[model samples]
Target chain A: MSYSSQAIAKPYFTVAITLFAVQVLFGLIIGMQYVAINIEGIMFDTARLIHTNLLIIWLLFGFMGASYYIVPEEAEQELYNPKLAIQSLWLFLALTIITVLGYLLLPYATFAKITGNQFFPTMGREYLEQPTIIKLGIFAVLCAFTYNISMTILHGRKTIINLLLLTGIAGSTIVFIFAFYNSSNLVVAKYYRWWLIHFWFEGTWELIMEAILAYIIFKVTGNREIVEKWLYIIVAVTLTTVILGIGHHYYWIGVPEYWQWIGTLFSVFELLPFFFMLLFVFNVVNCTKCHSSNKALKLWALSTPIMAFLGAGVLGFLHTLAPINYYSHGTQITSAHGHLAFYSTYVMIVLAIISYTMPILQNNINNRIVQKLEILAFWLMTVSMSFMVLFIAVAGIMQVYIQRATDLALPFIEIQNSMMILYWLRGAGGLVFFIGVIIYIIGFFYNRHLAVD
Target chain B: MKILTKPKYIYYSSLIIFICLLLGLTIHTIIVLPERDHRDNLTPQIIQGKMVWEENNCIGCHTLLGEGAYFAPELGNIYKRRGGSHGGAYFIKAWLKAMPTNIPGRRQMPQFNLTDEELHALIAFLKWTSEINTSSWPPSEKG
Candidate 1:
């Protein structure tokens, strides 16, 4: 690592990758449960709770890791306070561990009771299920992280990437506080919940992702001006589209009818950014004629936007309209889109950065064993996930036809039962994905000069 | 592309303008939300039931508003599908009381041992949820 503070990303990456592994393991169990493999105590719900929560946590840690590594290098300076950053990370980890353990050891209701949820009542929201205390801890950690990054940028060279990343971090940190404002009215609760969900996932998080992608593309292509140029366009398209695109979610969620038009019209442009992003990556690579021997980095760098386009752009567009989504909203189509979107958008970017940084941090390049494993892992994950998404999509289509579109609709249980074959196929894909994760994890350790977990 | 490459201030200004416009729309949302959701109908019992639903993390298995886990049927409309149509609150109560059918190779729900009071509250919650203005989602009762 160039700066001493950058080395702290090691623990952050460790937490991220480890949590990613367990998240997929839980995902595997959830897949099996769909195909009649009964996991008693954990069940489908609890396993899902753990799975989704782990995903959000690991991605957050990955973002933190990326910010820590990118800031000092971009700023041409060390961190504002290495000691405080380290302390903040430790506290963040401790609180997250406690939250995960609580989700496991204690029953849902029991855990809520113990955490004094009645006082604030923030527990059990989707993706925001952490206890009230854990929520406060998360806010504190975010404040520390935001302050650290902001101060670092303030003290050093402030580039476009640095400014955008700061805006994203600060915006998401602010959005998260909405989780604490609970309302007894379900519609009110769901209404404001989208402010956090849509704003972060589509708006702010894209800023962070684009900044990181631009950083990598520029590093590889040595084309700062071009990369920065495309970065602004991608970001501009993303916000203008996604800001109004939040209406797509509001359409059927007890919101006003104006959303029906507003959501659809705006979401039509949602594909622009992902498309532009794909173009940006390839244009830079071609412009610079990248002949890097780091095949793994090349693989991750290219796949990041391609898969994001497929997942978040195209698949998302399929259901973005109100009429189509009316049938597909709660079905497996959403699951299909959600899985691919999350995997490609956040997970792949994180992996891309890790692959690029870890070797350099440990002062090694292109270890044959690590190279082969990551490439193989990349293909395995991509192919299996594509299979998984396809099966789920087919099942979702069939489900819509049989369960919703038909004159005589079948019951939910019967429709689910009919999709056993697709469920089995999805489970198979999950098994392969689990193996891919294990392989990826093993590659991290095989580096001879390994310094980070 | 040339304009984009020339000045960063232009891009920053556009972002700020878009955000301000979105905020303007959000105020309209805030104004209409209380009426659109029929916030006045959210009774104390319904609120209590909501707390119970959350406390148990019901969203873990059952989707409330086309959101949450898809393992179970959407519970948001349960009040209309079962209660208002045929079965009513009694059926919901029996279903809750019936813990883990113990059917081999079938997904199971844990028994929460909810009190009679909680059961009534949960029914009230579902009833309120059914009445929300979801713009007619799910296409059919299959949800």
Candidate 2:
């Protein structure tokens, strides 16, 4: 908010939250379809594609918004090019809209053909399904974004946080080049895909998350030395553990058997950074004399590390071992882990930053009513998502037992039918989550007439 | 304060240890592990079949080698299940040709209306996939 260029982040944050609401709506639809059984026309796969794609796109939007806001402040400069940032935002939103509409309207194959996927043929493979042209467009956008941020850093203070964030952004962009490497060899294809997925999430994204969290803690506690020291340790652990953690996905893919041992042993260490994050946040909060009146931000800041530990750290360990994963692979257990991990780690961090920055950007302390509603939204979203995680974990455990563990194994459909009640419960949780999102959005516009603090 | 003021060597050494461990493990996984023999012999038809699978977005519904969606049964071992004792590619082709049984009140796969050539290629792809070492995944043929 110190720089006029930072205001460009406002549109990105607004759109990100809006898409988050849309993602939750799709979650409810898919959750309902799980139990209803008779709901037709919209296949579970179709809903799932939308759900997963929106999750990725919206999170990207959130990250970009965060970069726009954080990079300038850390660099002590205006954005390198605010106009380019705005253009990138619009282009990204437009492409996302067109891509989503295509997914909904046309058969995936026809859509692929229409998007010139036949030329390179990188359509199906999970999460990297965007057409080759769109992928190129994304690459272009990322280059522009990286250039803008990097130039600003070059012109101004090059703090560790900025350097780390830049490394993450640049590293992820480079890793994405492998998305186009859709070899016919599934093993080779999966190997490259993890270079994008695992490296981004566990490797680079952790650096980005840590940098941002460090920024927030510094702002709150004015403890630069302590925060920066923790940041270094966290990044070190992350780089060490997550690089090898990619082996976990290699275990079941057509890779060699050694990945079984390597994946499990390395993945066990992947939880350390998240655990350190929990300690970092709480320690900062405890030592700080200055309690920034933004209780909502403080709440989000605190929730992130704790929830991330439970979701990504503890639950990830539960299935990281090869023996357990053999049964849990591709089951709802992964889904449960995924839901909590992304929510706690990535989603909460984004929301936390937005909550902290939005008030400053508006040049006001939020009115009491707005603050109260925002806190309410926080509880509603966090509690309901936790419930969603619990219900899905229970569903996953039951599925593993009945479908894989038991002497008399059940068919997938029969087991799915037996888990209808849990699906219903999950759907209920989704409904509550949707309500929380709506409340969170409404809190933004409420009390607009009140005077600024 | 003492913890924060500790010499930088401890931190640097910890980082060094981490990098060494990661590099060692990565090399073991990528190079030391021998390649499965079947992978070195992929034919043009099998490659084409994999393209067909990707183009059609079959992974949206089916799990291949315990990857992809779990909405449908795992197809990584479909050849073993359909072929029974002797793994034949014919059953897979037949099954693909006769999809979307449109059964009442059950999940159904939409028919892609693949050409004969595409079907052949897809079956070949499945056959090749079945032969690759997946570390004995899917737990059983029930997948």
Candidate 3:
């Protein structure tokens, strides 16, 4: 490794992979619950809380690992504070364990009361449901992270990729302060929730995801100018669409009349960024002589754009227009979009960066068994998740037809009852997905054992 | 040539322009929220009800404003559908009281054991929610 501190990424990746396994297990439980397959202990809500919370936390770990690994090489220096980085990792992980236990053991309401939700009023809004204390702890963890990364960047050489990554980390951190805002008006509360959520997904998160992808492309192809050029274009296009296109969400949320037209016109263009990402990855890889001997670099690198285009671009556009979203806003269609878009863009990008850098960290570029397993894991997870999204989307379309659009309107319960079969297929897909994640985690450990031998 | 040679400058400038536009739109959106969301109707009981809603984690199972887990039916307009516009408070109270209907296989709701005061307050909050202009959502009362 170029820098001794790069080894810190190993532990972050290890923790992220472990939590990802836990997340998929919860996902399996929730999927089964949807089809009445008998989760005796955990309720759907509780399982969902664990599943989504773990997903967000683990993905954050992935980002931290990516930054820890990438920033040093880009800067040509050791990390600013590797010790503090390790401490923050442990601190954040420990707090997460306690918070999750609180979710499982305590009555959520009582837990909220004791954790000062009454004062902050930020508990139980999907994804931002952590108690005020834990949210504050998370803020502290992110602040430490931002400080470390910012100092590292300031002290060393700067590039567009590094600068964009910093802006993302800092911008998202700043917007998170908005989550503590509480509004008695449900409309306004929902409104700003998007401010926190959409900005992360489309704005800050997009920047981070693309910048990392740029780093990967440079690693694989040794085309710094091309990578930077594509990254700059993608970021500019993404921000315009992401910032203005938030109107798509505003359409149904009691916002305003103008958003229907405004949201539609802008959100439709959200496709451009993903399309460009797909095109950029292919053009860079295909046109350049790939410099890496890591057999799997191509797999991780190419798969992200292909899936991002399919999941985030095509599938997202399927329901992004105001007319279609009016019918499918909260249905399984949105769930389907969420699963694929998130898995394809954020989740896959994290895995891409992890797979790309982890080999360098170990100083072993070619591990045959690990490469095979990664491919197996890749195909299994992507195929099963694709099927999962398909089933969920079909269920959503059926729901719209039977419940909303059809003249013979069925009640919500009956519509759900009629859609049991799709839920069963979705459950089966979740099982496969869970297996893929488990296999992915086991592949890493198996490599470590071989390294020791 | 500039697109290739100096893409970074274009990137930063375009971001600034769009961000300014977003800020302007956000201000306009805020100025209109009070009228659209009916801020005058946010009574103490309604606000208290909102707190109770958060405390109970109602959004964990049910969607208010179509923004939560989809485990339960949409309740943003529950006041209109179940409360019959005039008697929404009573219907909501009774519904909250009845839990775990023991339907053999159906997903059961946990009884929150809310007091009468909490129940009334929750209903008031929902009533306020229902009156907000959603520009026609759920497409039908089936939500």
Model 2 lDDT tens row, B1-143:
46544534554566578658766765665664337526667889998898889888787877888777766778887887787447467777777778877766566788899999999898888877887778788886667
| Steric clashes per prediction | 1, 0, 1
lDDT over C-alpha atoms for residue B47 of model 3: 92
lDDT of 3 by residue, A166-258 (tens): 989998899898788877778888888888898988789888999899999998899898998888778878977888888888987888888
> Which digits, one per residue and each the tens of the lDDT, describe model 2 over residues A1-453?
688898887788888988998888877877877776545567666677778888988888888889999999889999999999999998888888887787777888888888888678888888877778878888888888889989999999987778878988887788888888887777778877888888888877877888888888888888888888888788777877887788788888777787788789988899899988888888877877855888888898888999999998999988879999999998888888999999998899999998888888777775677788889988998999899989989998998898888788887777777887888898899899989988888887653334354
Two-way DockQ contest, 1 vs 3, winner:
3
Off by over 4 Å in 3: B1-6
- Rank by DockQ (best first): 3, 1, 2
lDDT of 3 by residue, B91-130 (tens): 7887789887778667778888999999889888888888
Question: Which candidate number maximizes DockQ?
Answer: 3
lDDT of 1 by residue, A1-453 (tens): 778889877778888898999999999999999988865567677788889989988898999999999999999999998887789878988987898788888898999999999899998889988899998998998898899999999999998888889988998899998989888878778878888889888988888999988888888887788887888788778877887888888877887898888888888899899999999998789768775678999999999999999999999988888888889888889899999999889899999998888887777777888999999999999899999999999999998899889899987777788899999999999999999999998887676346443
TM-score of the B chain in each candidate versus the native B chain: 0.88, 0.80, 0.92
Taken in order, the candidates have interface RMSDs of 1.4, 2.6, 1.2
Sliding window of 10 residues with minimal summed lDDT for model 3 chain B: B1-10
TM-score of chain A of 1: 0.98
Better of 2 and 3 by lDDT: 3
Q: Candidates' TM-scores?
A: 0.97, 0.94, 0.97
Which structure is stronger by TM-score: 2 or 3? 3
Clashing pairs in model 2?
A: none
By lDDT, who's the top model here? 1
lDDT of 1 by residue, B1-143 (tens): 55745456656676788778778888887798877778888788999999999999998888888898888888878878885757768888898899778777566778899999999999988887888878887678767
